[model samples]
Target: MNWDDLRVFLSVGRLESLSAAARALRIDPATVGRRIARLEEETGTALFAKSPQGYALTEAGQRLMAHAAKGEAAFLAGAAEVAGQGGPGLSGQVRIGAPDGVANFLLPQVCASILDENPELELQIVALPRLFNLSRREADMVVTVSAPTAGRLLVQKISDYHLHLAATEGYLAQHPPIRALEDLGGHRMVGYIPDMIFDKELDYLEETGVSRVQLGSNSVSVQFHWVAGGAGLGILHDFSLPHHPGLRRVLPETIRLKRSFYLVRHEDDARLDRLNRLAALLSERLRAEITRQEGLS
Candidate 1:
């Protein structure tokens, strides 16, 4: 079996979808399907079960993955060792998946520094609404608010952030006062739709008997935009609040909630020289951004 085929199989197995694996590998979906088909032919057993939701690994596929993962690690380590003997002008692309908030507010400075230092390196930043699959290599690195549970992934807590309830002064003036958490019910509150991590935060408010929220778009930017436009009150990250002059924190201390941001990468990618350097640079830059924000506040 070709090592390339194995790589494709591993990606598909982790993501459970040919299309997603294809996108991660920067290849076409047809190529992903063909590689998996060839692998199955060589093994003389079905590796996956096709379903409407996505592809799932079969019993044999699961067993094959153990060996594939080991091989992949060995290959990457050897490659890195060889590459390390060369000069520092490493040339390659690093794909990063991050939340919209980070993409908009935090990553520009990081990007600038990465480009400044590694002029030969190319960086692709994919701003996603949710976490991308690092194990599948959908992203070389990920910045997320939710903690990842995948065993094959390496996660680092980059920073801690707080969220606060916010509203336009105009909106607050026209509507009832929001002195207490319960008083939030009297006003139209813009919030994330159900079944997202943001919803979990909103649910926390609901469980506290603060259930007066109107479902808004899932995008945090969208929710905050509405609040800025005087649509309604919504919870926003503390870092995001300073950018909008009209919006003010309604209950800065009492209604604050804290969450952590993580920088996650696949364990298999740890040995990639280019990836490691980029990850280090990103982590350092993000920490600096957090410190800067704290100083400004």
Candidate 2:
């Protein structure tokens, strides 16, 4: 009946582990277990079923989750509004999950400026090579290569950026001349491992008619470095090209690849003014930064 119990329930439901919920709620595991039991007793129904893979929500719990999530969102919205009235800047945590290329080259400057302006804000960037599980709240929001097709989410096209076949100037000077796309075959290639390409958008080499990756890594940073170090030619983002002056686009007229980044967040988060403002700022700055950096490239 109390908000505190409901809060505990939501935490356990979201995290699916007593110890994990305890850590997030800053309580002990035993106390979380007791509160959950007390909540179930008050409602006269078992809300969770224990199994080998932590706690699983029961059918009753599933029914309760919808109402509980709405209540939690409402409480957060109220708290955010109240806090906003007393402050000049946003506060609390905002975690963003993004692929490594954007995380490494794009978000650093954008997030730094955001942090400078919003001194009270706590921002985190999780850079991985694969899709983030928003259902687990792995991040508050994400910058994705493609708009996700399914999920209760708000997706916005953030910006379009270009990639091109690139090689270090020194590598090009020393290796076989690349006059066209077919010329790429004579040069060693750097790219993602064929089987490890997580998204169709990331398959940049597919259209280049290149069949093999002599040096491969799932990470954009690794592949970037391999090319920057004059290891080989590979497809590289224009925004990232400015980071390495020696890296030159190869066959720009024939091998240009354009891709867009999308901003995604939980639809429920739309009610939180603080998050909405942050997301707006993120989109605006990222778009501008992409333009500025790509201009330099």
Which residue runs does candidate 2 get wrong by more than 4 Å? 44-46, 85-88
Candidate with the greatest TM-score versus the true structure: 2
Q: lDDT per residue, candidate 2, 1-297, as tens digits?
A: 978988889888888999999999999999999999999999999999988799888999988877887787788899888777225687898899999999999999999999999888999999999998775678999999999999789999999999999999999999889887777878999999999999999999998999999999999999999999999999999999999999998998999999999999988888988888899999999999999999999
Tens-digit lDDT track for model 1 on 1-297?
Answer: 899999999999999999999988999999999999999999999999999999999999989987898788778767757766225765567788988878877787778777887787788888877758665567789898866675788788888877778888899889887777778768887776656754243343553355545756767778778988999888777777777878888877688788778898878777666677777778889878867764454
TM-score of 1: 0.83
TM-score of each: 0.83, 0.92
Instruction: Tell how far residue 225 is off in model 2, in angstroms.
Output: 1.0
Q: What is the C-alpha local distance difference test score of each model?
A: 0.79, 0.91
Best-matching candidate per lDDT: 2
Poorest 10 consecutive residues by lDDT, candidate 1: 199-208
